[model samples]
Target: MSARTVLLPALAVLLLFALAGSLLIGPAGLSTPEALLGLFGSERGPAARVMREIRLPRSLLGAMIGASLGLAGAALQGYLRNPLAEPGLIGVSGAAALGAVLTLYTGLSAAFSLALPLGGIAGAMAAVVLVQLLAGREAGTITLILAGVAVTAFAAALTSLALNLAPSPFAALEIVFWLLGSLSDRSMEHVWLAAPFMVLGWLLLASTGRALDALTLGEEAASSLGFRLPAIRLRLVLGTAFCVGAATAVAGAIGFVGLVVPHLLRPLVGHRPGALLPASALGGAVLLLLADLVVRAIPTAQELKLGVVTALIGAPFFFALVLRTRRETA
Candidate 1:
């Protein structure tokens, strides 16, 4: 059997295990049988309520968001032909966060919860459009990345400014911690809000796998092979925008999952961008679910921020990657 066939199933199994682990671990600490009953039973009791209302949504969102990020990362890296490319590198997440922050500061979310994700989608679309404009039609990878950096910095500054000028202390504090990201207190509404966009993104990104594979030989070669570069780029940009935007709207700005998952799983998938897409998605879900489980398991007074945990793990890995790249260049 091929490594792709074996690895894909293994990753799927790992994701399922992590999801089961996510359902079992929580503040209430239900037993396995009890958790199962609560999850599947028709009862409206406390355990069922907890299971149906909270943990289920959280687990689903974690999987969806992680998959989106991972897949987006893979798509971006493949399209841009740069190993370091990721969704956040292009300001999609940052702009989406800014949109959510605007909704919060303006009290639009209080009026309507759906407004938050809508705002995020708008921000994300706008940012992508602006980046595209800045990069121009014929721009290269470096130009595109530089444009993204500029947009990211601007969006981040605006987010900070909103926090600084927050109407209340509690609001500021909430925004501060939220920027660190978490899956806590999430509900089915959040799952409903973000899942559609994330799934759409997955579809868009997944369909580009063959084109990305072709482009590995270079744009001219891929064009010669009958792949339309413009369509491929459009799908890549829109896919990342939708996935990262909705994710930030619901879960705030969780980072590193995208950047780490594809890099880790690439070799296992024989370094084929097409094969790496699904592998990265599953790996991302497993990694994020495990991280969420870790935060719940830790006996701290307050659960650690999901972003904090990821950064602590990812930063070192990032540094190691940098060193490796440096050595190769040397």
Candidate 2:
């Protein structure tokens, strides 16, 4: 059997085990039997309430958001034909965070529970438009990357300004913490709100698998294979916007899953970008779920932010990747 054939099943099984761990293990200290009973049984008790309301939503969001980030990263790297490419390379995450910050800054989030995420989604869509306008129609990869950098810088500056001008220290602290990212206190309402956009984005990204496979032969070769480059680019941008935007909206600015997962899993799939997509998604989900569990397990006065944990893990890996890439080129 080929490596991919083995890899996919292994990853899926790992994901299932991670999901179970997420549901069963928590600060509440429920036993395995009690957790299972709470989830499966219809008892109207505290265990059931914790199982269904708190852990379940947190687990589901972690899986979905992680999958979205992973899938988007694979798609972006494949489309750009650059190993360093990631979902945040196009400014979607920064813009989404800025949007969420704006909502918090203006007190809209306090007024409306969904305003924060809605603001984030809006910001992400706006970034797409700004990027397109800056890159112009028929722009190439280099041009698109440049435009994304510009937008990211602009959004980041504005976000900082919001922080500086925040009405109070508490408001500033709230913005800072939200930017740091966490999955605590999330609800099923968030899951329901973000699910449709993420599902649509996944379908769009998945459809490009064949096109990405062809593009590996060069854009000219992909064109000769009857893949419309313009159409492919459009789908990639929109799909990424949907996935990353919604994820940032719900989970804050969790990073590095996209950058790290595909690179780690690439060789196992024989470096086929098409096969990397699903594997990366599963890998991302597993990574985030495990990270969330770690956040709970750590004995601290306050829980560490999910984004902080990911960055702590991912930063070292990123430095190693940079050195390795440089050595390979040298």
Candidate 3:
């Protein structure tokens, strides 16, 4: 009956159709209509394997990674009260990439699949700790952004240096892909590999929903309302690092899902932090699944990376925000 009421449901329906298209449209298109029937067990075809093994897991992983990125981004933005805040900008992705790079390039992942995620989690944890030490309890927005910039720059530099110093061709290629982010040929092993950690990370982040809402006014106001600032800070940091780390372990460095999804869905959820989290997650899953489908459909002969597509879409959007801010300040 009204603008606010009509728009959200319309957007939701569109997102659902996009998701269905993602499951159906690909380089090897699934029977889709039949597969939808098969989902209800009314039909059978060659699509069963394609849908079950490849599309299903890829869709699931895309959803997982997208949700993780979206939640992390929303958490950072709410925690810092800055619209520009994203996990990648704050060194989470770089730290996670660095960790995975070390394990995979050093030949450790060959011996142990868990090594990749473990290394990423460790690197992310270390970076966050350093950020806490430098920024401290009295940090303002300027301090928070500055600390994140410094850590991200340092982690990126170190990652480049390691790639340059790599001992072999395999190491170099692995580093390149780690930075680019892909979902190609990813199997059930990867599904299981990152799922538990991703789920755990989501829980940790979701726990901070109330804290983020409390932070809207000011630290003093939030503290007066019985929110523990220190505990809030800890959960935000650990949850972001763990989830981002685990995601990079499997998906490499997919960008912009965190940056794009929350900003897009914030209005739909009435700007409520808890509602923002779930709305962003569903939106993110849909976004990444579609992007992965594009990567598959494009006739590159060689597959395109997921990050490349998302960054191309997101980079201009970010610059537009920057310009909008400058105009507003003026």
Candidate 4:
């Protein structure tokens, strides 16, 4: 049997288990049976309220956001033919975070519930445009990476400037915490706000799988295979913007899931970029859900931000990956 066939079902099952853990485990200390009862039972009780209101939304958002990051990462990597390509690495997530910060700075978020996400989406779109303009249509891998790095660095600088000039200490703190990323205190309203954009993004990214496979044989070959390069690029940019922007707006700047999940699962899927997308999505969900559980379970005085936890784990992996790449090239 192909590894893809075995890995997909395993990932799906693991995702279910992660979801269950997310739903059942919390600070409230509800027993497994009680949690299940609260989740499914029609009873209007405290357990049910906690299960339905708090944990459910948090779990769902984590899964969705994780999937978004993972799928976007895979798609970007495939399109660029670079394993290191990721939304966060490519400035998409940073730009989205800057947009969310602008909404906060302008107080538009307070005035309009949707303003924050819209702002993020706008920033993400701008980043895509900038990257495309800088890299050019026929840019090589080095050129693309340089463009992304330039964009990411600029976005981070602007974000830092905003924090430095924040109206008040309280506002600065809030922005800092948000940028660190967490799924805490999120409600169903956030889920509702982000879901449509994320779903649309998923559809757009998923549609590129066949094109990505063909492109593995090179751009000329893909064109000969009847895939329109310009259209594919458009879909990828739009899909990534939608996914990363909505996710960052709702859940702050969670990172690394995209960078890590695709690389980890790529070999499992026989290094086929087409096969990697779904697997990465499932793996991302499982990783994030479990990370959420860990943050909650940890006895820290304050809960660690989801982004911090991911960075902590992924930074080492990233270092190792860089070293491995260097060795292979050397």
Candidate 5:
């Protein structure tokens, strides 16, 4: 059997295992069979309530959010031809967070819960447009990354400023929880709110795999091969904005899944950016589910934030990547 076939199935299985663990490994301490029964069977009580209300939504969100991040990461890395591109690095996540925070600060979220994701979507779209404008079409990879860094810093400053000047203590608290990134107390309402946007984003991104493959040959060559650069760029930008924005709206600005998952799966896909997308998505789902599970399993007064665990793991890997790239260049 080919490696791609084997690797893809293995990743899928890993994701399933992680999903099962996420459902079964919560504080309820239900066994696998009991959890499954609670999830699917007509059993009334705490097990069913926990299964339907808590674990299900959390697990679903983890998988969807991770997939969105991973897919966006692969798409960006493929199109930009850069190994270091991600939503957080490029300011998209920060902008999305700012939008969600705006809803909270303005009391829109309190009045209308759906307003939160909508605001985040708007913020993410604005960031995408801004980033594209900052990084001109002919810009080099270094130039693009620099623009991303500038935008990221600006958005982060704005977010911090919002937190500092929040209208009420509750607003500040909301911002703090969001900035840390947790899936605690999430509901099926969140699942319903974010799923449509996430699904649309996945479709748009998945459509670009062939275009990304053509892009590896350079813009001129890709154009000559009948790929419209404008359409591809729009798809990637809008798609990423929708996915990441919805993710941030529901779960806050969880970072590093996009950056780490694609990087790890790249080699396994034979370094083909096109082939790496699905692998990264599945790998990301696995990683996030596992991380969420670990956070729940740990004994602490308060659960560790999902983003904190990912950062603790991802920051070291990012540093290693930078060092390796520097060594290779040197």
Candidate 6:
């Protein structure tokens, strides 16, 4: 077989290795075979409880959230026809973050554990609706981006005002943590709470692959090929809000998973919009899980936030992308 045929299997093996490492090694370390057996309940021990109670859900959430963000990124990039487009960059994530922050600041999250994620969905929905009202309708990619820019600025202002007026106790640090993002201490409840919505979001985005591909040539061309722009846009907006919102609600505001994942895998998929969606989802699952693993293993007095790790990796790559895109357009 040619070298071209070898790429996928290699990536698959790498993903498997990442998954294994995530499960086996952490602050509370578990041996390889022991971890596997622990998963099924045969091996009852401290390791088992830790695996079952703590690491397992966090790992699963890492994968699920990463996949959601990656898939959301793929959808936005395809629909907007811009490689720089990502959920967070375009106001969806910011809006969700604002919603989550509101609950956190109000002390409602303390009383109602489920309030954060539900409120996040509401925030994301509001943002999507606003974007639709402001920038929807076959706008060129530049116009959509500018509209997103405007919305992002407005939302940021609103979030800042909320924070300023928040009660004295637990205000600053909570806001910082929520904005920075993390996956630590997450429980099985979070796993169950967020998974269904994330899965539904993925399904909606995944099904749009063909439509995205059709849309690459332009809405007129896609419509000629039987694609409906309004319906596709609606699905994309609602789907992204559900997935990304649940994720942000559960994990705070982990940045760049959506942006980083899709960009990282684009070359592997021959830059095809359809293939980018799933490949990005898988690649994202790997990246976020591995990052979580790294965060847990570090011996720092205070545990590293999962977002800090991913941002360190994502920021440089984002700059490179900007340079490359500018070069291409120039």
Highest lDDT: which candidate? 2
Worst 10 residues of 6 by lDDT: 2-11
Model 2 gets an lDDT of: 0.92
**Can you write out model 4's per-residue Cα lDDT over 12-131, one digit (the tens) per residue?**
999999999899889999999999999899998999999989999999999999999999999989988888888776678889889988888778888977787778878888998997
Of 3 and 5, which scores higher on TM-score? 5
RMSD of 5: 2.1
What is the C-alpha lDDT profile of model 2 across 1-330, one tens digit per residue? 877799999999999999999999999999999999999997889999999899999999999999998999998899899878989989889999999999999999999899999999999999988988887777288888998999999999999999999999999999999999899999999999999889988999999999999989998899899998878887888898998899999989998989999889999999899999999999999999999999999979988999999999999999999899899999
- lDDT, model 3: 0.77
RMSD to the true structure for each prediction, in A, is: 1.4, 1.0, 3.1, 2.1, 2.1, 2.3
Instruction: Please write out the lDDT profile of model 5 over residues 46-92, one tens digit for every residue.
Output: 88999999999999999999999999998889988877778566567
lDDT value for model 5 = 0.85
Error of 4 at 150 (Å): 4.0
Segments in model 2 whose C-alpha atoms lie over 4 Å from true places: none
Clashing pairs in 2: none
Worst 10 residues of 4 by lDDT: 138-147
Better structure of 2 and 5 per TM-score: 2
For model 6, how does the per-residue alpha-carbon lDDT over 1-330 read when each residue is reduced to its tens digit? 754356557656766777777777876656777777787767678878888887788788888888888889988998888777887755777888888888887877888788887777778778888877887676455656776678778878888987888787468677877778888778898999898888888888888899899987888899899988778876887788789878987897777788888877787778788878877887778888888888877889888888899888889998998888899999
- Candidate 3 TM-score versus the reference: 0.86
Candidate achieving the largest TM-score: 2
| Candidate 5 displacement at residue 173 in angstroms | 3.1
TM-score of 1: 0.96
Over the stretch 1-330, how does candidate 3's per-residue lDDT look in tens digits? 765456556656756776677667776654667666544553455666667667667777787787788889888888887676787766767887888788876789789766776787777777788777766886355666677788888888888888888998778987897679987766677788778878888898899899889888887898899998777876777778777777776778888788888888787667766567766766777788778878888889668899898888889988987898899999
Please list the residue runs of candidate 1 whose C-alpha ends up more than 4 Å from where it truly belongs after superposition. none
**lDDT agreement with native, every candidate:** 0.88, 0.92, 0.77, 0.88, 0.85, 0.81
Candidate 4, superposed: residue stretches over 4 Å from native: 111-114, 129-147
